[model samples]
Every structure is written in structure tokens, then in C-alpha cells.
Target chain A: MNRDFAIECERLSRIYRSGSIPGRGRETPALTDLTMQVPKAVVFGLLGPNGAGKTTTIRILSTLLAPTSGSARVLGYDVVKQAKQVRERIGFILGGDRGLYGRLTGKQNVRYFGALNRLNPKTAKRRGDELLERVGLAAAADTLVEEYSRGMKQRLHIARGLLTDPEVIFMDEPTIGLDPMGAQELRQYIPELVGQGKTILLTTHYMLEADMLCDEIALIDHGRLVALGTPDEIKRNFSRLTIFEIVVNQTSETLTAELSNIDGVQHVETSAEGIFQKITIAVEAGVDARDQIQATIGAERVESLVVRDPTLEEAYVSILT
Target chain B: MAAALHNIALQAYYSYKGLFLWLNWTAYISNVFIAPVVFVVIVTLTGRFAGQSDSANAYIIGMAAYAIPAILSGGILQSFCYERTFGTLSLIYASRSNRWVTYWSKGLLHYPNGLLAAATSLLFGWLLLDLDFSRLNWPALVVLLLVISFSCLCLCLFVGNFSIALREWIIPVGITNGLLLITSGVVVPVDQLPGFLGEIGRVVPLTHGLSALREAFEGASLGDLVDDIVYELVVGLCYLLAGGFLFSLLEANAKRTGTYESAI
Candidate 1:
């Protein structure tokens, strides 16, 4: 384990056995032996589809559930043996827009959790004010939390997470229920926290959010890490071929066969819209198929062409499966 | 220690504040006033209808006098029960506050309010029911109420052990409240029961409590029932100590087994 690593795990796993009935016994494994590390002072995104064990990992790290086997640590403290210390070092905001006291004012709710973190009354009060201001909730400080919109509540939840000034924070789907504007506000705050040297562990399904905010990502599937690296790195490494779409004359079949026969042409497909056909051809970057394609199909047959780098979604779809 | 106490108290207050916003304060506020008044009124109504040997005023005073203990018992137990059932028990057990500090703060919260309600009930009964306290035994009365309250407070400490281990509080709440009412002789005098049932009542904390209450206002001195009063006090103390030890044992087991959160 790196000494500077903010989090480390060695074959961490969890198996939630079903409670035994009078005559039957059964069990299910929620997490496999997954090993990964999150370095200090950076945003590490845990990306996965729903039911892919992303939340389970967060739950174990947060000390909300005991791991069935192996070991894990957050901020150098053993999750089980030093839960109190770990709790002090890491604040968690769970997904699904829960974790708020809807009846209390936002300021009061923050103070309550601050108290739970053992902050002094005066200090808790001060932290509450500072956090409210930090999250742009100062104006709605005294208003009941129930009255706040979903976006506002999410902002308050983020503010609550910062109340303890933890060294590392976990945000699970922080923008799950927010509109574009609310997501924009939360997205804007991530960089500021990163600038302050706070190590953030964020989990989100939105690839754009991950690509925009996270310095690194570990893509999880079926309780396994399928890919792990920087966003750009994953996209570059997974993108085997560049795709080009050509709108040509309806008789583009002859051109398709010739393009397929080219040295680096990997695959070709076409869609017909009435009499016109839009042909898509993928070729390896090192070889040029344009000459062969135009030579066989003719200049008139090739009306227009578009070539672009692969998107993160395309890369993810190609790698995960 | 003070830091922990302040934190726990603030957290409890915030929970109550949250409850208030949801119109859930009925349960808490009733502990201070409504429950105690009900006890006093029940005793008074029973006394009038039955024309019992004791004056209606005396019955009211006796019942009202036990209000402090009743309130303490009701407050601690009710608070524990409600918090546990509502999924907020985590607020107490996992709190940054020390166990003893949290225990005492919760125990003391009901005393002042309970005593006030008791005093008010007694004043009302004395003025309207024409009961005489001129011959009342003040020292005996004070000791009786204190002992009774202490017993219930001790019971609270024990009930808390179960609450911590098993968060489904309905069973504990129903059992505790029902046991207190039946055994305390609050509804019917213990002497009226026959044989073993009556014998069981004699050993109950409420029997001793009610006996002391009646004796005090009837001008009976501590010297008159010295042995019984002493016995009740000793039994109450034993329950307190024994319950505390058992609670500590259960709490240790709960933490180790990681069963506290799964109890509900």
C-alpha cells in the first residue's frame, strides 16, 4: 500500500447471507474480492451500472455495514477496528436523496449532525453558518428543510457532509434527483473542494459527470472492476478503431464490399432511408481506407464523410459487457 | 464529560425540534402533564365511587404524590421506546455522548415537570375535594415519593438495556406500562386481592409506593411501617443495581455481535 494512499483495500468482499428459515438455508454474495486504492487529495469516481456493487462498496467503507471477509481502510484507519476514527475522517452522503431531517430548518439539521460528530456547541454553530454559506444555502438557513426543492436539499446535504471538515468525503449519486441547474451547482463545488486538498470518493452513473469531475475512475460491472484509469486514458485505450459515416448514393453496396476488403477496414454497416443509404465504416487509425472506398464507390457515390474520435459511452460499451 | 453531555443534549433537543415540526410532540408533552393528571384523576374518581376508607382527598394526594416517580419512569421509558421504534435509537447508542451522562440527562428531564404536575393536581384536589392534610406526615410522604420515583428510574435504566439490544420497543413499552399499572395498586388496593395474587402485589414496587402514600396523608409515621418502607426501598435499590449490571453486560454483547443495528 502507498503511504500517501487515502484509502486501501486488500481483497475486500461482503457476503450478505439470507436469514435462515425454519427449514431452508440460503446465502448471496454482494461483493467479490475487489481490490483498489484511492490516492490522497483527488476525486476518484466509482462508476458502475445499477446493482453492480457500487453502493455496497461505499457502505462498507462508511462503516454502515461490516465486511463479510478481507480488510479495508479509509484514511489509514481500519474500517472495523477504528470505526470511530474512520467516521471522524470521512463524511458520507448516501444516494437516493435521503439523509435529511425534513422537519428541521437546514441550519438546525446541520448543527444536529455536527453535534453527533462531537463538535462543541459554539463550534458547531459556527461550522453550520460557514457550511450554509459555502453551499449557497445561507439565505435558506432558517427555513424548514421540507420547503426546500430537491436541488436545494441536495445542496444542503452536501453542506452537511462538510460540517465535520473530514479529510475524505464520499458522495453517492449526489445529483441523482436534481435538475440541470442543481447538478450544475453541485458540479461547480467539486473543483473547489478538490482545490482545498480534500480527497473525494464520488460514485455516479452519469458518464459525463464522471468525465468532467473525476481525475480517475474505476469502472465496475457484475461486481468486478472492468476498467480503471483516467477518463482520457480509458477512452484512448479502448477505442480500437475510428468510425466514419458516409452519406452516399443508394447503390453504395459495391463500395461497402470494396471498403471491407481494404487493408484496415474492420467493419461496415449501412442504413437505408427510403432510397438513400447512410453507410458507416470503421477502420484502424494507422491505415487509410478513404482511397480504396472512393476508388471503388466513385466520387459521385460518396456525397459526404464524417470521422470522429470515440466518446466515453462508446468506449464503455465496448469494454464492459 | 461536559462536552459529551452538551453534544447529546443538543442532539436530543434537535430531535424534539424535528418532532415538533411533524406534530409529533404529543407523546413527549403528555409525559409531563397528561399522564400524571390521569393518574391523580383515576385515584380520585375511584375513591369517590367506592367510598373507600381513605378520604377522596387523601387518595388524590397519594396518587398525585407518586407523580414524580411515575413521570420519571414514563419519561425515560417512553423516550427510549419512541426513539428506538422510530429508527432514531442510533441517536443515543451511537452518540458521541457518554453513556452515564446521557442516562442522567434523560432521567432528570421529567422530574421538574412531573413534580409541577403533581403539585397542581394535589392543590386542585385539596381545594375541591375537602381532604385534610393537617395531620399529614411530611417526612414519611417525602421519603415514599422519592423511593417510588427512584425505583422507576432504576427500572428505566434496565429497560434501556433491552431497548439497546432489541429496537422493537412496542413489546417493552406495553409490558412495562401494563406491569406498572397492574402491580402498583394504582387501580385497586392490593389488600383486596386474595391469596397468592395479593402476596405478589405486596412485593410489587407500587404496593409499597401506594402504602407509603396512604400512610403519609393518614398521619401515619415512618415508625408505624418502618420495616415495610425499608424493605421497599431496599428492593428498589437492588433492582436498580442489578438492572444496571445486566444492561452493561447486554450492551457489551450487542456491540461485539454487531446486532444492535439489526435488532429491529
Candidate 2:
């Protein structure tokens, strides 16, 4: 309930139960003793794989689901007792086409959500028109939404989410079905919303997107927080592991086995690059076995080699796995 | 107060428009317009064949009145349950809308459509059955029909909310429509059933309204039909209150169980 925090949860947990019989029914724990705080204005990414409690957490913060235990607050309001207050200060966009009405025109869909958010007629119209233009949908605004492309539908969803001009926004898989260009445009849009001092909590499965967009990230797996930090900081956690990228005209099992036998080497992956084969070697930080690897492979066969730090994605995989 | 009413009105209009699969053009026309005529003609002719020609007018009036529930049962259910199908119902639950306003609006515009269906049914009755409307009190019949169709809407929402909360979506509407058809003096008089069923019919909407319609058609004055009119209105009011209670109750259960987010 801290005023400084736009979104806060203390030991928030949720367990979903099925079937009519209470004790006899099966229980699935979706979130377990999770705790985090999001500051007033930043894109806070909830990074996770699938079935990793990301949606459950987002739904709880959005006031769409009640926690089985613990507590969550949005803008200093308790989610259960002050749900209306939370709802008033927040707008959320779901990932796919499910939440929108297919028969309504894009403007009509926007107006409907605007009204749901209790916007007056003038404000709803003005803002709806503005957002449609912002999302590059003004030309198609009058068309029925079902006739729009998937990317267009996603843009309409974004317009609806911003209709309320909320203080905190929650988006689940916001770029789920967008094309590369569409996703890139949305990536630019996220920062502008944050620049307006609105806190955004977005769940994402894309490691690169999280690295590029998030001000702070909390990585979760199996309903627990596995890691939390800036992209650089998280990647620095695995800085002690160095990656060696090698290219050669050819590669064989003998070379791979020889590379594996190196004292501090961890993994060797090989893939084709046109007529050449690219070999990647991950080894411990201090073990700079450049000579041993070069001598083992014969210097004439080794075309080139480069050493670099593990990327955010590689660090994420190493930490989680 | 004004804003709340606006929300209700917008919700009513948009929900009805949004929930339509449009029913396909021909299917909707036949169901709402053509089928009522066939129902009235067949039932009225059957009464004549049974040597009960005296019941022909009664059958025509009952079948016409039935057009409201027939349309509303599907109409109300579609609008009420549509959010779940599209996975958008949770959007309202998650928003800053008043519970009463949101749920009440789901049943709002539907009854107006019910009134139109009943009119079509009666128009067919007037044309095909040669049912006489010369002495019928037109104003009194319109008013009674409005109240009766509204009451049927209240009853439909009541059953839809309570049963959907229990995860029974389709069955309750089916059962309620059949029960009303049998017990509301449609096709057969309620008094012909068991004593308890007759008492049941006395309170359900449309039973008393249809009775008043009969008296009005027989040249009875509006003042003389006050007893049936009052009883019909009272039944409607009761269902209206009950439907609100059940909707609030359904919302509470859904929130507690954390099942309010999606229809699936």
C-alpha cells in the first residue's frame, strides 16, 4: 500500500480449484508467495515461459481475479475491497481477439469500452478518434472489426486500453500476434506511454523484447520468482561464462569431441552457415583455451573465432534451467 | 443518476447488437415472423376439430401472447450468455461499472423486441384465423402486452442468472419456456391442469395478462379488468426484484471463486 509504488503485492498467491466437491476436487496453485513492486512510471516486464503464473499475476493486479491468499494493491487501493477504485485508475489489454466485439466497428468498439470506463460522450468520441489515428487505424476505423487484419485488431485493443487514460496499465502478451513491423511500432509506443508517467506491467515470453523494452524485469518459472534485475544486470549474473563463436569450412564428431574434452568447456553447438560450419563454445570465465582449441583443430582448418559475453537470453536460459 | 441511466441504455442497445450472430437472415425472419402465424393457425384449427370451437379465440390469443416468451427466451439467453462465449464478460467485472446497472441492462432492450414479435403473432392471428378484433380494446391490450412482455423478460433473466451461476446454461431456459407454455394457459387452460399447477399459473407472468386480454376482447372495460392487471403487474415486479438479487449473488460467487475473468 505504499504511495510510491504504482503496483505492489506482498506474498501474493493464488490457487485455482475445480469440481463441485470442495475437498475432493483438484487444486492447481498458479502463484506461490510472489512479491514485487512496480514504480510510478516504467515498463515493468513479467518475463516467463508458459504456464508460469504470468497471466494469473496480471489478472490479479488488473482486478479480474481474486488471489487465493496474500494481497495486491493498485495505486494504493486494495484489489478486493477497493476494486472499483483500482479499476478506475487502470486499463488492461488482453493478448488475442477474444475481448473485442467482431460486429462493432473499430470506433464503436472503442466507444463501448470508453463508455464502460465511464467516459462522457464528447470525451469518448474525441479520444476514440485520436487513438484510432495513433494506432494507424484511422483509415479503417469505420470498418467492422471482424474485417480488420489480426494486427489491426491488436491495434484496436491497444486503443481500447488507453481510452480510459489510466495511471497504470496491464497488458498480457501485448504483441502476441503482431508482425515484426507491427511489434516494432508497439515497442516504440510502450516508451511513449511510460514517458507520460503511466506504469505498465506487461507479461512477455520473448526474451529479446523484454531486454529491449523493460526498465526492470522479474523472471518467473513454476510460480516462483527466479530472477529480477535490469537486462544488463541479469546478463552480468552469468558474465563468468564466456562464449566462443568459431567458424570453419567443415566440422566433424572428432572436433566436437575434442572441444568437449577441454577442461573448462561447458557446451559446443554446431550449425551450418552456407558452405561453412559455425561452432559455438561456452566455457568458464578464466579458461581462455584459445591455443588448446586452435592446436586441437589445426590452425589451417579454423577460419575465425570471436569471444563475447552471454546475452540476456542465454543468461535467462542458464539461470532457469 | 443520469450517467448511470446512460450506461444502462448504452449497455442495452450495444449488448443486443453485439450478441447477434444475426441469426442468419431467413432463420431470424421465419422464427420471429412466420412461425407464429403457423402456430396460431394450427392450434386454432385443432381447437375447432376437437368440437371446441368456443376455445378458438382463446387459442389464438394464447398463441399470440406466447410469441413474447418464445422470442425472449432465446434473445435474453443470447445476450446474457454472450460475454462468456466471446470471453469478454470479465471486462465488465473488472471495470468500474455498477453491478445492478450492468446485469439489468443485459435484459433491457430484449423485451422491446419481444413486443414486436407478439405484435407480428397477433397480426397473423387477425389475418389468417379471422379472429375478430372489432370489439377488442386496442389501447388496453397494448398496455397489458407491454407489462406482460416485460415480466417475461424479468423471468427469463431470473432463470438465466441463477442457472448460469450453477453452470447450467441451456437447460434452465428450456425448462422454464416449456413450463410456462404448459402452465401459462397457452394451448390449454391452466384450470384444466392439477390444482397446484393452476395456482402456479395464477402467479406466473402472462397468465393474468392473457386473462385480461380475453376479457378485453370480449368487450369488458379496462376498469373491469383491473384485478387481473394488478396481479400481472405484481408478478412482474416480484420477478424483477428476484432477478436483481440472483445477478448480484452470481457476481459474488464468481468473484470468490476467481472464475470471473473469462467465459471459458
Candidate 3:
């Protein structure tokens, strides 16, 4: 148990013995031999597709479930052996669907959960009010959660998760069901929380959110971790394969051979779309094929010639596949 | 420990905040007034036809005796079903309140409401039937209600915790309601329930508890009600202990398995 690490899991795995769902039979392993470490105050993103074991990992770390076999520690407390301690250290927000109760007011819901966390009435009330204000729900704090818009409800849920003032927060799809503006609101708020020195572990399949918010990311697919690194680090690793898109003014069959003949040009494909020709060229290692390719294609007919570093989306696809 | 209990109680109070108070009071009022009235009317009609020497007041006492455990069993099981169905039970688990505090507070708070209803109805019934209980066995009646109520609360938690599937909530509520309706000895005395059924009925705390209640209203001494009261207390305690233990075990297992959400 490293004092500086907020979460540590060694060979942690989960096997869900799901009852057959129509077309499938037999138990399936939701997670397999998973291992990860999250340092204190770091915003780590668990990036994965649907059913990619993100929720399973969060649940295990939150002490909501025991692993089938392996160990997990949250804030220096063993998840299985010191579940109550682990629970106390970690605040968990489980998606938008499990938002605050529709009938209770925002303050009321927060106070209710605070009381359950063993806060006295005065302390609970004070904490609840502070959290409501922090989440920007203080103006509508008295209104029933049912009256709150989707974003307000989401903020209230986040407020409820903070009632205990946990050192580590686990958000399993914080902005999944939110509208664009709602997602943007959380996008701004989350980084602020991270700035407050709270370690956050978030899961989302949205590359944009991961890229914008995560300091470090682990990409999981088909229950296996495929990529783990900072966004810039990952982009740098995949930069060696440069993709160039060329739009030509005229269609020419001979252009393929001409582009391929350029130094370091490994692959070229051209497709004609009405009056314009779309060409893709891949440059080989240690190659500066741009000027050579431009000259070969005759720059006057080339409407666009752009070469750039890979986006997280392109990098993710390339790494996962 | 007290703070822990207080926190648990407050959480439970809020969990059932709006509708529970109304529903519980309704269940209480109906149990107190309507149950005994229905029992008295039926008994009086039969007595007139059969020309039996049995007093309507004695029947009222029997019905009131029946109301005590009826309220207990019905109160606990029905609320458990409602919590399970409405997804509130899972919320409680997720919140991390002490399970024992939940069981205790739920039983404690709801039992009073049930007892209030039972007493009000029984008092009304006794007045309507011209009953006098200046020498009633107070200890026996108190013992019966307390023992039975605790047992019912335990049983409800036990069943509710174990049956995690949404559909599983039905079986326990149905079984409990059916058991109380037939074997409660509130409507028909245990002796008239057929030999095998009567023996099973006797083993049920409902039969013995109701009998003790009748004896109490008839001015039976504590000594006279001792055997039956002992039987109710002993069996009810056993059920309470066993049921509570089982419920905690299931709750821990469910948390470990991450099935709390699916179960609720």
C-alpha cells in the first residue's frame, strides 16, 4: 500500500455469473486479470466501450463488490478486509440514472445520505448546504428533484456523492446522459474538483471527454487493457504513421503510380467523387514524403494537402484494433 | 452505539418519509376499527342464529387479540414488500446504514403504530360488545404483542433481504399474508380449523397469542395465561433471532456479490 496512491489493484478481476440472456448461456468473465494503480490527486480516466469492465472495476474499488479472486486497496485500506474503511475513503457516483430521488429536494437528498454516512444533524445539514452550493444547486435547493432539469439532477447527484467529503471519487459515466451543455458544465466542474487535489477515477467511452479531462487514461476493449498512457504520450507513439489526405481537381488513373513513386510513400489510394479526386497516402518510417508527394501530384490541381498529428480518436482506433 | 442507532433511525425515517407515514396510519386505523367491527358483527349474527351462550364481548376480545399479531405480521411484511418493489431497499444498502439498526428501528417505530391501532379498535370493540376487563391479564397481552411484533419484523427483513429479484418480493408478501389470514385465529378459532390445520395453527404464535388475549379480556390471571404467554414469547424470540441472523447473512452476501441493484 503506497501512501501516495489513491487506489491500487493487483491481479483484480470480476467474473459475473449472469443468467443466460436469451441468445447466450453460461457464465462470463466481465473482467480478466486487471491491474492498475492510481496516484493521489490524479484524474485517471477508464476509457472503454459498453460492457468493457469499467463499472466492475469501479464497484470493486468502491467496496460495493468483492472480487472473485485478487486484492484491491483504496486509500491504504484493503477493499475486502477493510470494506467500511474503503467505503469511507471513496465517494462514488454511479451514472445519471441513479441520480437523486425525484421526490426529495436537493438539500434533503444530500442530508439524507449524509445522515446515513453517520454525520450528526447539524454537521449533515451544514455539509449538505455547502455541497449544494458547490454544485451550483443552492438556488434551486428547495425545489424537488423531480422539478430539476436533467443537468440539475446530475449536479445534485454529484453533490450527494460529496456529502462525505471523500478523498477519492469514482464516477462511472459522469456525463453519459447529459445534453451538450450539461456535459460542458460537468466538463468544467470536474477539472475544478481535480484541481482541489481530489483523486478522481472516471469511466467514459467518449474520447473527447477523456482527452479534455484525464491526466492519464487506460483503454480497455473486450475485457482487456489495450492502451495506457497520457493523451499526448499516446498521440506521440502513433505519430510515426502519417496519414495525408489530398483532394485533386481532376480524376487521373496514372496519379496513383505517380504518388507511389515518391520517396518514402508506402501506400496510396485514390477515389473519384464527381469532379474531385480523394487520395490517401501513407508515409513510411523516417520519411518526409510531403514535398515530394506534392510535387509528384502537381500542386496546382491539389485542392488540399494536410498532414497532422493523430487525434485521440484515430489513435484509439489504431491502438484498439 | 447510540449515535449509530440514531443515524440509522433518521435514515429509515427519511427513506419512507412521505407515503409511509400515511399508509402506516391507514393500516393502523383500519386494523383497529374495521377489523374488530367486522369480527363482532359476524359473531353476533351467528350467536343469534345458533342461540349460543357465548357473549359478543368475549368474541370482541378474541378479535382484538387477533388484531395485535395481525398488525405486526401485516405491518412488517407489507412495508418490506413496498420497499423491495419501490427500489428503496437497495438504496439503503448502498447508503451503508447498519443493518441491525434498520431492523430494530423499523420494528420499534412501526410496532407502536400497529399497537395504537389494535388498542383503539379493541377498546371500541369491547365497548360495543359490553365487555368489562377490570381484572384482565395485562402482562400476557403486552408480552404477546411485543413478542409477535418483533418476530414479524425479523421475518420481513429475513425474507426481503434474501429475495433479491424484483419478482421474488411477491412470494414472501403473499406467503405471509396468506398465512396470517388463515391461521391468525382472529376470524375462526383454532379448534374449528380442522385437526391437522388446527395443530399447525397452534404452533403459529397467532393462535396462542389470540388465545392469551381472550383469556386476558375474560379476567384471567397472569398465572392462568402463563403457559400460552410463555409459548408465544419463546417461539417469537426464536424466530426473531433466527430471522435477523439470516437477513444479515444475506445482506452481506448480496453486497459482496454486487447484486443489490439487480435484486431490488
Compared with the true structure, all predictions reach lDDT values of 0.70, 0.82, 0.69
lDDT, model 3: 0.69
Q: What stretches of model 3 exceed 4 Å from their correct place?
A: A18-25, A238-298, A301-304, B1-5, B18-96, B123-147, B162-168, B191-204, B222-231
Task: Rank by DockQ, highest first.
Answer: 2, 3, 1
Cα interface RMSD of each candidate: 4.7, 2.2, 3.6
> What ranges in model 1 sit over 4 Å off?
A20-23, A236-310, A315-320, B1-5, B19-39, B47-113, B120-132, B137-171, B188-211, B219-264
- Candidate 2 local lDDT, B179-252, one digit each (tens): 88888999778889899888888878889888888878888887888888888888988988998898777666
- Choose the strongest candidate by TM-score: 2
Against the native chain B, each candidate's TM-score is 0.73, 0.92, 0.76
* Error at B119, model 1, angstroms: 3.9
Weakest ten-residue segment in model 1 chain B by summed lDDT: B255-264
The alpha-carbon deviation from the true structure for residue A77 of candidate 2, after best TM-score superposition, in angstroms, is 0.9
lDDT of 3 by residue, B1-264 (tens): 666656776666655452142354576566655765676557655764676546565566655555555555544554454555544454456556666666545555556655665576567765665566677767766766665555545555455444443435446656764665577576567778878777767655556666777777767777887787778767666666676676576657665666655411
Which rank order by lDDT, best down to worst? Answer: 2, 1, 3
The model with the greatest lDDT is 2
lDDT value, residue A128 of candidate 1 = 87
**Candidates 1 onward: DockQ, in order:** 0.28, 0.57, 0.33
Candidate 2 structure quality by residue, lDDT tens digits, A1-321: 589999888899988898898679988898998999988999999987888899889888877778988999999999888988999999887788788888888998888777676777678889999999998999999898889888898898889888999999988888989899989999999999999999999887888898899998888888988877777777766445778888998677789999999988888888998888998888877887888888777788878889877877777777777
